[model samples]
Target: MMSVPNLDQLDANALRALAAQLVGELEQRDRVLDETRQVVAKQAHDIQFKETHIRKLTHEIAILRRYRFGKKSEQLGGEQGLLLEDAVDADIAAIEQELINLGGQPSEQKAVSQPKRQALPPELPRIQVRHEPHSTTCTCGCQMQRIGQDITEKLDYTPGVFSVEQHIRGKWACRQCETLTQAPMPAQVIDKGIATSGLLAHVLVAKYTDHLPLYRQEQIFARSGVRVPRSTLAEWVGVCGVRLQPLVDALREAILNEPVVHADETPVQVLQPGSKKTHRAYLWAYAPGVFQDLRAVVYDFTDGRSGAHARAFLGGWRGELICDDYGGYKACFEQGIAEVGCMAHARRKFYELHQSGKSLIAEQALKSIGQLYEIEALSADLCAAQRQQLREQQAKPIAQTLHAWMMAHRIKVPGGTGIARALDYSLKRWAALTRYLGDGRLPIDNNWIENQIRPIALGRKNWLFAGSQRAGRRAAAVMSLIQSAKINSHDPYAYLKDVLARLPTHPNNRIEELLPHKWQPSAA
Candidate 1:
C-alpha cells in the first residue's frame, strides 16, 4: 500500500481537522455503548416484571379454582352447577395449555387414591396373659410331701379406660343441731355444661382459622349427628368475644406503645343496627416494634375510615408509621406521626399499567423504579448499617438521576398518560419516598402491611361478606387475635380457647399479657 499520509507532516489546520474527526468518532462509539447498555437493562427488566406477574396471576388462578371447585360438590344454587361443561372445560384447557407454553404449570387434579391396605382399628386391642404354676415333685417321687407352691406364671393388666367422677359435695345438717357445709366448684369453660374447653377451641379454630363460616360449620356438624344451628355458633362466637375483649384491649395498648407501627385497612360488610342489610365498614390493623418491646402485631376494627378511628387506635402516640397511600392516614401524619410510604404501592401502580399495556412511559418509569429496587435487593444481603451506607452512596445518586429525568420529561408527557400519572404520584410523595434513605430502620416498601392484609382477603373470598357491621367488627376482633397469635407463632386455636376459657375469670389488670407478645402458655 501507498505510504499512509503522515498527519505530522500536514499543515496545522488539516491536523486540527483530523483531531476533530477522531474525537467525533470516539464520542459516537460511546453513545452506541450507552444505548446498548440501556437496551440490555430494559430487556432484563421486562423479563423480571413478566415473570413476577406470571407468578401473581398463577397464584390468583389457584386460589380462585380452589374457591370455585373446592366448595361442596352440591349445586350452589338452582342455576349454578359444580362441574364445568365440556365446552367450558375445553376452553379452560386451551387457556391452560397456552399458559403452559409460556412456562405455566398445568393445573393438576390430584386424586389421592390411597393404596388399599387393611384398615386399622381406631383403638387397639388390650391383650392380657396369665400363667399359673403349681409345685411339682419329680416323676419318681410321686408320694413326696407337699412343697410350698410356686407362682411361675403371672397375669398383667393395664387400665385402658379413664373415668372422671365429679363430686358435687352435699350439705348435711346434724341431727341434734343445724350445721351445713359444702365446697365450691373449680372454674371451667362452661358451668353446668357437657362440652370441654378443647371442643370449644376446635369450634373457634374451625370458624376463624379455617374460614369455615358458622353456617357451613353447622352443616358439617349435622353430618356428624349434631344439630347445632348456625345462629347458635354465631352466638357462641359473640360470647367468646365478650369474654376475650379484655385481652384484645390489652393488645391494643401494647401496640400503641410500640416505636414503629404498621397500619392497614380493608373493607368489611357489617349488619348495622336497624339497617335492611349489612353496611360497609373497615378493619384497621396496627403493629408496633421496639416501643412496646413487642415482636407481635395487632389489629383493630372500626365502622368507618375516619381519622378519628386511627387517632383513637393510635391514642395520639407519635412514632414511625408504615402504611400505604390511603388518605385516611393523612390525619395521623398531620398530628406529628412520622409517615413512611411503601415503595411496593408505588411500584404496583406502574406494574398495573405495564400489565394493561406496554406503554413506553410506563416502561420507562418502571425501569427507573427498577434501579431503586435493584439497589434494595442487593442491600438485603447487607447489614442495616452497611445497607444505609450503600443507600447513601449508591442509591442516592440513582434517585437523583431519576429525579432529574422526571423533571426533564414531566412536562413533555401528557398528564393523563399512565407513566405520567406514575411519575406524578412519585413526585407528589417524593419526600416520603426518600424517607427510607435517612434511616436504616425503615423498610423500602409497605409490603409489611400488604402481607398483613392477605389473610383477610383470603377469608373474605371464602365467606363473601359479613352479616352486618357489628358482625364485621366481631370478625375483625377475632381475626385480630387469631392473626396476631399467628404472627407470634402461637397456636391460634389453643390461644383463643384458653383466652375464652380464662377471660371470664382472668384478672383484668394483667389481661394484656394474654395478647400474643405477652402471652405465656398455662403451666402444665
Candidate 2:
C-alpha cells in the first residue's frame, strides 16, 4: 500500500500556502450560501404575498355580501342603503358605458394626435422717443417731429375679488332707557388666529390634501408676495389638530361602536420626541364602514411594530377586524378579536405566483374564488334579505366546492411549496375565511381600507418621512378626515374649510351631527 504524505514533512512556507488556498475556498462557499439564503427568502416572501392577497379577496367578497344583504339598522338606515345601492348601480352603468365607448373607438383613431396650444403673437410694433434740436421748434431753437401718435396705455389686471362684508350695527341707549345689543361674529377653527377660516382651510389643504410640505408652502406664499414662515405653518397644523381632536375623538368612539370596521397600517418615520434622528412608527387607520358615508376613519400612532400597540388602540373592543394577513394581527386574534382577511391579498399572491410559470395550481384556486365574487356581484343592488336568499341559492354551493377543493389539495402539497403554503394559510384561517358567508355584516376583504391607505403611500414617496411622532399622528388624523370626506364624494378641501369655519361655534353636545356624514354645506 502507498503511504500518505505527512504534513509534518512539509516546509512552513508550503503549509502556509495550502492554508491560504483553503481559506479562499471557504470564503467562496460562504458567499454562495449567503446568496442562496437571499433567494430562498425572496421565494418565501412571494409565496406569503399570494396567500395574503387571497385573504384580501375573501374579505372583500364578505363585505360586498353584507352591503348587498344586511338588514337595515340604525348604522345603515333606509336612506343610506338606498344611496349605497344607487351608487353600485351607477358604477355598473358607468362601467358598461365605458366599455361601449372603448369598443366604438376606431383602430385608426389611435394615430390621431392632440392639438397643441397656439404660440404667443410676435412683436407688431416698437415705440421709440428721440429728443433732437431741429428747425420745427415752435418758440425755442429746439424743434421736434412726432414719429407716431403719443398714446396712453391702461394696464389690464384681474378684477379685485370682493368678500362678503358683515356690517355689525350695534345700538346703545341711556341706562334708564331701553337697550339694544349686537351679536359677535361666530368663532372659527383657530382662536384669535390671524389666518381666516378660508385661509386656514387652504393651508390645511395645501399641507395635507395636496401633500405640499410646509417649506414648499412658504415658498409658494413668497411667490405671491405673502410671507408665511415654515415654522408658523407647522404650528398651525399642530394647533389645527388640537382644535380638531375633539372631532377626531368623537369619530373614533363612533367608529368603535359600529358592528363592522376596516383596518390597516403603514410605516412612518417620525422624529423621536427627544432624539436627534427620526424613529420608525406605524400609522394605524380604522374606518367604520366599507363605503365611507358618515363613516369615521381614525388613525393612531405607536413607536414600535408590536401587537401591544394594536391592542392599545383597540382596547377591550371585540368587533370584526378586517385587515391583511400580517402576523402582527395574529396577536389581535389571540386577544379574542375576530380577524377577517382580504380576498385582494389572496389574489395578489396568485398574481405574483402567476409570474412564475408554476402558478397554475393557484390560478385554478383563484378561478373558484372568482366564482364566489361573481355570485356576490349578482346581489350588488339587492336588499340584504334578497342577497341572503341569493347566497343560499347560489353562493353557498360555490363556497362549499371551493372549500373542498382546498382540503383535497392540502395533503398532497408540500409544507413549504408555494401552492401548499397558500392552501395551508387558507385552511388554517378557514373559520374566519368562511365567517363572511354566515354574517351579512362581515366584508370579504379589506380592499376599501387599502384603497384609502394607498394615497398616503403615494404621498410618502415625495414627502419621504414625517418630521416627528407628533407630525405623524397629525397626518393620520387629518388624512382620516380627508379620506373619509373623499369617500363620501365630498370635496375634501371644501369640507375641511366648512368644518374649520363652523366647528368652533358648533355645539359640543351636537358634535356627532358635525361628523362627516351629517355635515351639509350651508350658504356661506
Q: Candidates' TM-scores?
A: 0.63, 0.64
> How many Å off is the CA of 418 in candidate 1?
1.7
lDDT of 1 at 156: 14
Give a tens-digit lDDT track for model 2, residues 55-132. 543444344334434453422334323323322222222222222333322111211221232221222122222222
The deviation in Å at residue 116 for candidate 2 is 47
Identify the runs in model 2 with alpha carbons over 4 angstroms from their true place.
1-186, 273-276, 291-294
Q: Candidate 1: where is the Cα deviation over 4 Å?
A: 1-183, 289-293, 378-386
For candidate 1, lDDT tens digit of each residue in 1-524?
A: 12336876899897787777778888999999999999999999988876776676466446434533454542133211211111122223333433454576745552242122232222333232222223223344332333222221111111222112233333323333333333344465444433345555666677667877665666775565445544334435655554555667777777777667788888866542222254667777777632224665566667778878888878868988988778878988888999888877787887888889977666777787788889888887676688789899988888888878887888898889777888788888878888888776677877766677788877766665554443455566777788888877898867765665576577877777678777787773
| Candidate 2: residue 516 lDDT (0-100) | 77
lDDT scores in order? 0.62, 0.62
Model 2: lDDT equals: 0.62
